[model samples]
Target: MENPWLKINHSDYENHMIEVGQSQILNSLKKYCLDKYQPKNFALLGCATGNGLEHVKSNVTNKVYAIDINQEYLNKTQEKFENQIINLELLKRDIQNEELAIKNIDLFFVGLVLEYVDPKKTLNKIIETIGKNGILFIVIQKNKQTTFVSKTKYKSLETLSDISNDVNENEIDSFICLKNMELIKKEEIELTKSKSFITLEYRKKE
Candidate 1:
């Protein structure tokens, strides 16, 4: 696997997501995260180009582990937030690999990433990394569509057209509860009139 993600331009990806009302969705996520968890330390899985990063408040979140598999994306994040965040940690790791560690994280945000990894195994690994009383946030598409290319195309992301896979929302929800992760809150963000994504907040059971 070439990791089509590495070919994606972080700026273009963020811009496209913004056009799809991702900013609004991320804003709501941020509000819910801060009001509910108030985590001092957190991790943003697949934190590409720092989209939705504005929601991370300095006073509330002291340390952030901005993780992404692609080095270019991490590089952009470093450049964008180097001066803003006081204690920032950039981790380059693949979520599908067992070597990826998120141990003791107060909050974990997995946005638009489960589609690419083995959901159950990856979730298990991530849960183990979350400390007791920690929170995990996941964003999953309500509607399923694979093998589709973007309306706004970028030279780097052209290769992503070949990607095709299913991330069944129902299956994901089932796995979350099976792992003793309780669903605290769930909301659907209408990205478009017809397309939307559901955000599920799960807290560690013990």
Candidate 2:
């Protein structure tokens, strides 16, 4: 089976997301965080082509770290935001890896990326990489049992509870375990023209 995250084309997906207003999720995330902390540096875990970067406050944020596993995605993001002059750093990294070049992040954004990684360890790694009291804004697909095929494979809202049953289990509960984090705020949004839903999970250091 092919890895879905690796198969994503950042440029294409970013363009589509922007056109469809799917990128609004990033804007919402920024608003949710800026309301709480005055972060100087921001890290976007799955910063695909840096689509919604323009929404980030330039004066408050001096640097933005964009990390993705696909080199093509990183390259596309770098090229797209090359002239933004926001000190953007495009990094090609498998987020599952424990080692990272940067740490003590002020704000960490994980958007629609956790479902593809080992959720438990991924959350722990994210918490470990950020500073104390730092903010983590995550947006994950809620349902995974009823697969739907529009342009991608996803689950229906009805089965969300079943799939998330073991919130503590390792393999079957990728989405719900995220809620175990010390939540600061959370909201649910239904996608346009899809059977999928998004759960925005926000957290602060415990």
Candidate 3:
């Protein structure tokens, strides 16, 4: 199966997210995790064009890993943050297929990525990389409309509709609990009249 994300440019993705009023909200949510967790080692899964990376403080976060399947996205992130962030690593690998080499990461952020991949397989890989007591911040979209991809001027984003799937909160909770991770908090942010983002924060048991 072809990955639609690779075909879409960062500009188109960002524009679509902005059109749906998700760019600012996503950035704020990522900032919230950074402030609350205060992690020394931070990892962002499916980091698209590094939208929320501006909030990372180099003094607090010594190492930052930005992983994405698209090499173009990784390249853009490197061009933007390579000088600003200390010890920044950009990985071009699919979370569903490749083994994540990151270990002992204090915080892992998975935003709007599970819908495109196998949740169980990806979660297993995530658990392997998170350190003891590591924090996991996951954001999934809940749609009131039948279409998973919201209408936007950027037609390139329409390709994602083929792979995107709606994820249930209860199913995610059950999977994480079985892995010995406990939910710290959960919040739902309404993006538009027909769309909302559900964020789940979990901590690995020591």
Candidate 4:
């Protein structure tokens, strides 16, 4: 079966898209965490085409594990960042699958990926994989409900809140509970002609 996350087709077109706005978001995320301890091992979710891979300082990041559901996108990302020599391990795995091997992630970067999966399960897996002192950087989209279409399924920020509400009732008291993780910083940015973006930095409890 084909993966839904691997949606981009043309490499040039994807690169253009990244160059325009995605790169800006990636830069903002990097700047927020650059002062933190240099991450030796980094894991990125929804790493499409590896455009932001180049932004990660080589001296700080020795190994990077890029995960995406689509094999095609993974292949593209691997080929695009092959010369970086950062021990990039491209894995084709579904985030919902609990059997995947992921642990001790110094920095876990998830951008516009969680909306596609079961938010509660995805957060549990992420919290489990990241070390006690590790950090998680997330970028989520916010907008009006009518902006989304059936052909392209994208969850709004309110939808994410709803998912968090369910998790709070069934599992945790709050999605961004300070007991488990503490929010260090947050910034909201607007895109060219779409929804707003919010980047959050969270430090896991020791």
What TM-score, computed on C-alpha atoms, does each candidate reach? 0.88, 0.73, 0.98, 0.77
lDDT of 1 at 84: 84
1-206 per-residue lDDT for model 1 (tens digits): 77889877777777777665665677567667766787888888888887767667788888888989889989999998888888889999987874555578889888877766777877887888787888999987655352333465455655655653456767788888888788888887766555577888889878
lDDT (Cα) of model 1: 0.77
* Worst 10 contiguous positions by lDDT, candidate 2: 160-169
Q: Kindly list the per-residue Cα lDDT of model 2 for residues 35-141, writing each as its tens digit.
A: 55667878888777765676667778877888887788888777777787368888888877745577778888887666666776677777667776677777765
Ranking by TM-score: 3, 1, 4, 2
Report the lDDT tens digits of candidate 4 across residue range 29-63: 76556446578878888776665677667777878
Candidate 2 clashing pairs?
Answer: none
Question: Could you give candidate 3's per-residue lDDT for residues 1-206 as a string of tens digits?
Answer: 78889899899988999888888899999999999889999999999899899999999999999999999999999999998998899999888789998899999999999999999999999988899999999999999965899888899999998898999988998999999899999999987788899999999999
* TM-score, structure 4 vs. true: 0.77
As for candidate 4, its clashing pairs are: none
| Residue 102 alpha-carbon offset, candidate 3, angstroms | 1.2
Q: Give the distance in Å from residue 123's predicted Cα in candidate 4 to where it truly belongs.
A: 0.9
Q: Which stretches of candidate 1 lie over 4 Å from their true place?
A: 144-150, 155-158
Q: Which candidate is the best by lDDT?
A: 3
How far is 13's C-alpha from truth in model 4 (Å)?
6.8
The candidates, ranked best first by lDDT, are: 3, 1, 4, 2
